[model samples]
Target chain A: MKNTFLNKKNLTWLILGVAFFFLIQLLIQVGVITPYYRVTMYWICLFAILGVSLNVIIGVTGQFSLGHAGFMSIGAYSAAVVLRSMPNLTGLFIGMAIGALISLFVSMVVAIPTLRLKGDYLAIATLGVGEIIRIVILNMKITNGASGISNIPYLISWPLMFFFVFVSIMFSANFKNSAIGRACISIKEDEIASEAMGINTTKYKVMAFMFGALIASLAGALYATTYYVIKPETFGINNSINILVIVVFGGMGSLTGSAVAAIVLGIINNVFQPLAEWRMIIYALALIVIMIFRPQGLLGTSEASLKTIFSLDTYKNALKGLIDLVTLKKFRVAAASTGKGKQR
Target chain B: MLEFLQQMINGLSIGSIYALIALGYTMVYGIIKLINFAHGDMYMIGAYVGMISVTTFKLPFVLALPATMIVTGVLGVVIERIAYRPLRKSTRVAALITAIGVSFFLQNAVSRIMGAKIYTFPPVLDNRTFMFYGLRFNTQQIAIFVTAILLMILLQVIVKKTKVGRAMRSVAVDQDAAKLMGVNVDRTISLTFAIGSSLAAAAGILVGIYYNTINPLMGFAPGLKAFVAAVFGGIGIIPGAMIGGFAIGLIETMVSGYGSTLYKDAVVYVILILVLIIKPSGLLGKNRKEKV
Candidate 1:
């Protein structure tokens, strides 16, 4: 376990990931890509982080939090406030750290009450909490009211943003594979069973929630830097729902799927920007269609295993398994309907 | 003293509307345990329908109100059929996300069709403020309060005395058992949605008249607040929802009247959080232990 991070395979993947991001940065710096494309990629990185972090809570832990955007707002404001004094790399790091700490605190505060309650109560509570956070920000003098905090220094360059995104992905993946992650999954599978097994459900639930909030705040810090503005309203229920959509669409509990969905949906958001009003309507419709047809999401619970990162056989087998599942589901649906008809 | 009475009067009117919407939320949640996020949009649609009936078709307020109720009620049924029924067996999170999706669809679709502008509701009743003693009240307030109370009483009688209502209660307790008992569970659920949505529609029209304005996105805030009200009252209980709605509405009005108007919405949310924290089952709800 101690040597795992230092192993050759892990180091190779790390290097490859860095190289891939660096190549993209080089393309942008050398004018090989449009500024718009560069911006879109930045959004992808931000959203991917958001999606993966939320997956830890909703997907892995099986808790519903409609307040990720509230945590994001906390991070955004904390980072922005810190940046007001120090607008350099040191400030960015300190700001993000501060943002993460605040988010963890807030998550703990929210979790203590709602985590003890039964089923989807947290969702409703968080929905209200998120709105409360936004409204409080609106009335606060420090947040500059509805005009929002703007014109922060751009400390999050493409490289820095990519590095943070990489860190988020790696951290989440490691967590997902670790003992604590397993505990979280067990709770999700069945909270009572896990509790009966002597698993401290509340402790793991809070930890996962705080971790998700930390990553969300980190994303928020990056969002504030990249866009150079942060508005309270932007981190409302709509934003929370958007992250939930990405998590559900990417297949909950599947980190790789979250990343993929985030990138895809981010691109879709940009492409449909011309018809601004229709974008949300289409996204909403897509959500309904996907839920109806593929409730398990595109990837379901299948995850990208690092051991099979470059294995063609693994990919083929996974694809074949997915096809089998789809056909099996179709057959079951047909048989059930016909069976009902026969009963009549 | 006069001002206090005025504020209380205002609070009751708004609270009546909240109670109406809250009933819808409570009824739907009672039956399905899913927060019909689109329920608020039903109210919004109802308001828009009322707006159309009055402005475009020149219908009277009485005619417009029922039209809005029927349209919104049917819309609720269709929404449940298309989005909710398929995902009933899935994870609660899936159903919730789908509800949010339906909400988004309704809000955006209405906005697109209506051009996203705030329309002034036509003057239905004459602006006649009657003063009794030291407190002043308007015709609109009286109409809203009277209509809201009558509707609530009617709902109470229906739910308490009717056969369909009994089926709804049975389904809420245990769906499989209800089905075994020869209840048409699906129809019962649809009927619940219909009744709830019609109440929300009534609230919407009343609010449109009181506020003298209508918009596509008007339902979002009030809808959320009404959910908070439902939770505050005891989510699955009918009377709890009514009490919760009035409490939230009064609290919001008072907060705005005495404190900062900006914190009004925040106050309602704060109430929701506090209620969940202190009493997750709400004021009227009995705490049920989850079974393994």
Candidate 2:
């Protein structure tokens, strides 16, 4: 009887989650969410997806990559090309899948050879690779080079997008707690230590790179599918910078922080699209401000766990605990040593 | 053979511009280990200053060129003090991010004030062509080469002979040791930026005259290309930057001229991949692992 009651609660939560998503989709579709906010919200959702993807590599794995837009450009162009060739909803799915796979493969090819280098070289190499990809796309015969691929099929709906976002979030969050996640965090903390401990540090780093690229490609695929158009410039160095800012602004290790930063940046980016010439300047300024003022990101490595956010006492204690840790490192040291003494 | 010679001549001019610009990247990278993405934008600003000096200030070509270079050099110092100085001891990534922000801010600020349309810059040299030994040459090309070489020699002298240069070198080798030796590390950094920015500025102005037009986005391609050159030649070495800059110009010019123009990006990337796969330390840079 108790088991049955637990199952019933689980079912109810699942229903509520689905219904909640459906309700939001309905509101947006029927104009209840306001057309004034649709495009901006869409960008937020997409950027949330991108930020989470980047957080996998940049935040969790602690690797500096500058070629994110290269993968994204490939995804976007692949989807755009495929959808242009075949204009069915099924085609959209097929194209996105194919595009994403291709992106994953290419990212592996790039990362495998390059990720071995540390510090400034990786940064430079990734940047070079990104520019190379941009220039290649700019010169390609199929994608129309600098003119950009246009008139892609608009095959995305709000529900479909929401579904993908949910899947990406769920997958990323789950991965964050997995054994692989632990290994990655260990590597990030100390590559030498991790290597000494028999972690295939190179393999794990490559995996993180591939994983981040795959998710970024998926986001890019979705972006291209929805807009029915994408240009090389759209996925150029500046786009890479924007995504980097989001990842940094979100707190590198926190999925929830990544999502929040993405959404906030997305809204701002979309709203300020009218400032076409100075849009990049605004992004740059925002980055400088964020780095100077709030280097840990808005959420600072804290997850938006339901229990933590919902419980008043938990939130207060967590806040107080964090303050204590920051302001009183000596106290933390004393506490740790005392705990060690107790164990002894 | 003659055609190849002409191509080499053309490449030398453009390559020198890249070398000048790469100096900005290499110096900043050597001192602080941060790739100032906005260094290219500083070149753009220099060009604009030169344009204003010539057209608005009504200075002669030579006077305007040096004046613009000085202005740009000053701007570089100001930017270093304002945007980069605070984050000096921070992680390399923080500075890199800040540089990106500064680049965008300057580009946008320029666009907002100058408008988005491509601006026409007045020609500095007469478009006279000279033929020698069945080879044709442009006056502007010759002038570009001469000016760049003169700047290179001047730079070599300053870096090698000057006391400030010695101070700069010491700072590059070990910041702490240099500071302990009574060198003002901050001043050296400022001076490095000033000199490097002036070189880049001169390149920008020279390109404006060579190309006869300027746009806000003009610096991006050359900036990236020059960065690649810095990487190719070994980023911290001045001589390497010069060689790498010319090599890239030749590679680009030859590839674009020989192969379809479309393959330009492919050629460069292919080379980058090959070099990285073979020699990750660059052609000149020695391997120094980051001791994290």
Candidate 3:
């Protein structure tokens, strides 16, 4: 395998990411970002990590898992247990390690049997598993049942969250470009064809699922530590759907898309926090509109790169399209009409 | 023994409502192969419509029930036309995502309009208890049971003996072939939605009268449970949905009665997973091997 980390493009992006992190840290130190907004930033990082990780299973591997919150809760609770006793950075890392191990075990057990089911059946089965996990947590004594675990010392700092999010994005992006990711993608495109090619579809699928579970667990640990209180209700089907919305809204299979969408949606949510009722209404409408108009999502599995951003041809094509729109071009109208006619 | 009998009766009553909702899920899944996650919200709309008819319009129970069914039935058709039909040629995942979006839209829209408060459904039926074979029965339970059975019978007659039923069956089997045979595939699918949604609406009204409370979010749990019933009975199989609904109802009641109530929901989900693992096609679903 090529050295993905040492490449010129990767190095430049890595430097840019660190520079951006420092800029954010500077802003926080200067009192520009309030505590409330900082919490929202934490959520954005959490969701970005979740979305990127989930994209591996649902996007790269062609598996529809609706039980992500199940793995997340396992991580949150396990980490909460450890942190409740220790309440330090070392405790946080230990808790995260423990959470990842548990999630690894659980994902293996779940993915082995459930991965055999196809499409909607898999979705429903995962949903059932997620709900079952939540219910069990709700009834557990150590988790405090429905009341949830409270007074967890807030150990997750902004830089720590940024580090985890950066790690998750890099890991998933690398996975997508690797041979195993190619095998998983082949399975997604056509399972029988991949199997004919002698790929171990089930094994790769299980691997991707385990990877997703591990990262999701890490995010869960971060979530528990950042929020100071972890509730079973926080990891319900709705939470799973919220993470799903992030992944889907960002083009599936595109790590950049997941991160972009997480940040955009996170900001939208925070901006509309006061108009809580209208916020969900608008969100639902946006989902529907996006599905109808752009089913491929925001980036459509394509990465946004510096070369593409800086290429003159890109700007020229965009300018041409804009000019066409302004000039009421007949060809554009004709093309649209023809497309509609084809639908009929 | 007497308590068991009473629980059995209670289970049957609740099971019938679940059956009504499950029929809608099974029918929609049969035609388009989409899970129609929004079907549950249709039930919630039905309950609200029924509540409004009784309280504001002062319609009697008999009249309000049909009114609710008609309104929600039409709404179902409109939703299919607007949200689902446009995505007919897209990937199944896109359609599924759209369905989830529709579900959220319905839930949030209702909550926004209705203020998310739990409205007390006016007592539309008489409240009376009677002893039957050393078991206590309430008038509302008997009424819900009887009405659900009648609706199921009516559905059976329509499906088996009517031309629209034949169209639905053929469309379910193969939409393109049915279209080639001049089946008006779109209309048939719409009709299926209408029928399924109407059944769910009737269940909603019955539930409202039974529980004496209605809310914007009340349909989520029952909708999921009914979906489990539909899958358990064999998704896309009419009879399977009915049997699955009642079976889930009975199992849930039995679990709550003998075990802890907290675990009842968990037990239902466990059953769903077990059925998916042991028999993905469900109890009555025919196992068809994948050609590819």
Candidate 4:
């Protein structure tokens, strides 16, 4: 584990991340990055966290869960409730803890009952769970019943949001790099085969769900703190689908893809605020078009690692593939003409 | 006793609409093993088309109903061709996502064109309530019940007695074998979509008339409930969908009547969870173990 973390390649990426972090801070301090841009940055970070967490379930574990927004609501509401009594940073920690705990419990509860189902059935069941959570929130007196919990404390700066984003990405990447992540990926590849290999498919699936739900809860807590308002409607099926969209757009099972897609899409969402109503339509079309043309998504199963990029290894492979395709076409033409000549 | 009977009657009326929508889900799932998420949009489109036929074109209820069905049926076929056919060999997850995208596109497009606000449906059926043995029944209720039941029976007859029906059942059983047996698999699939969409269109029109109001987003909740009903009965079974729809409608009405109306939607979801956990195969479906 220590070696993996301190490996020369990973260390380079780590140092680069720190440098980028410092650069962003310097820009913010120098007033070159405007306040509006800072808000956009916050959103991008939040979405990155969301996209990565959801990727664990949808991408790595190969389970279709539409209840992520429910977990977020749990985090946001619990955080809001905790903040109501104590308004300090410690209070925020307590809120996030409460949210994470509850979401973990909820994931376990729901997963136990519905994880036995496969494919679209599991998807619908999770969707039902999400709807149930939303409705319960809507009716709960403590949630203020649709009026929502308001005036929560906030993180107060860009660097703080960046800190959370960086931590979340690293944490998720580390988890994806671990043995447990391999177990989860095996399940995604073939649950029956994974079971045959003596992997505890059920246990791994539940753990993946719990971990994703826990992280989603944290993102929810951050969202609550950042916005200072928590509405039941805000954490509905639409939000769950939005996160799913990000995961799919990024290439399922690719952590780097999730982060990149989330950041890019987040910026696009902010820049095109006036066309917000049309955003869902566009996302839906994008999903269809992408699924039809490239089911592997924008990045496929590969990542933009430093070695591959700096060394141009991927470009070389693409050039090789192009040459192979041209040769194969010529071979086919020659074979077809030779067959015609033989017939003549 | 009288109030309970009235509630049961009301439940049956709403249940009929659910039954219509659920049949579409069942047929499509039976044939292709896909959830056809955009199906709910077919219902919404039907409502819109029915509304247009009545309010804008001055057609009678009778004319509007068939017109809506035809329009939605064609629309369903088009959707299958454009959005789903190419992804037939792809992963179910991919197809599912595409289905969602189609649903989203339809919903947003409709909302963009028609505006999101609720519009009062033009009164077509007479609203006079008649008391029979201390149970009240209205014209709209009777119409919905009779039309839904008749349509369901007609569907049963077509499926059981017609050549197209035989083709559909064969394709549903095994697409490759059906193709080898000289069945036009593509055309049969299109027919399935057409039948399902038309049924949904009927349900949409009935819902609009019953509620006397319509909106672009109207299909979302009912669509969900009908899906639950489909699962409740047995996803791939025709009669299962009908029974499930009525059971759900009854369950929902009873909950609203006896319990807090705030938790009505929650109750439906709870039932779905319980049903899924306890008997994933549903009421009428046989358990089929996964092949390793």
Q: Quote model 2's TM-score.
A: 0.90
Query: What's the residue-level lDDT of B48 in candidate 1?
Result: 89
- Candidate 2 clashing pairs, residues 3+ apart or interchain: none
Clashing pairs in 3: none
lDDT of 3 by residue, B53-95 (tens): 9999999998998998999999999999988887776667777
Per-model C-alpha lDDT, please?
A: 0.86, 0.80, 0.87, 0.86
Any runs in candidate 2 off by more than 4 Å, and if so which?
A1-19, A269-278, A311-344, B289-292
* Candidate 3: stretches off by over 4 Å: A312-344
DockQ per candidate: 0.49, 0.27, 0.49, 0.48
lDDT of 2 by residue, B140-248 (tens): 9888888988998998899899999999899998999999999999999999999999999999889988998888888877887788888888878888889889998
Which candidate number has the best lDDT? 3
Runs of candidate 4 with Cα error greater than 4 angstroms are A1-4, A311-344
Please tell me the TM-score of chain A for candidate 1.
0.89
Better of 1 and 3 by lDDT: 3
lDDT of 3 at B15: 96
Reference-based lDDT, residue A58, model 3: 91
lDDT of 2: 0.80
lDDT of 2 by residue, A1-344 (tens): 25463566446546765997989878877888786576677777888888888888877887788888888887787777778778887777777788779878888888888888665567767887888888778878888878887788777777888887888887887677678888888887778889889999888888888888888887888898777678888988878887888888777788878887777676766667786666776777877655544445566667776556567875575455445434534433433332321110
Candidate 4 CAPRI level:
acceptable
Return the TM-score for candidate 4, rounded to 2 decimals: 0.94
Worst lDDT 10-window in candidate 2 chain A = A335-344
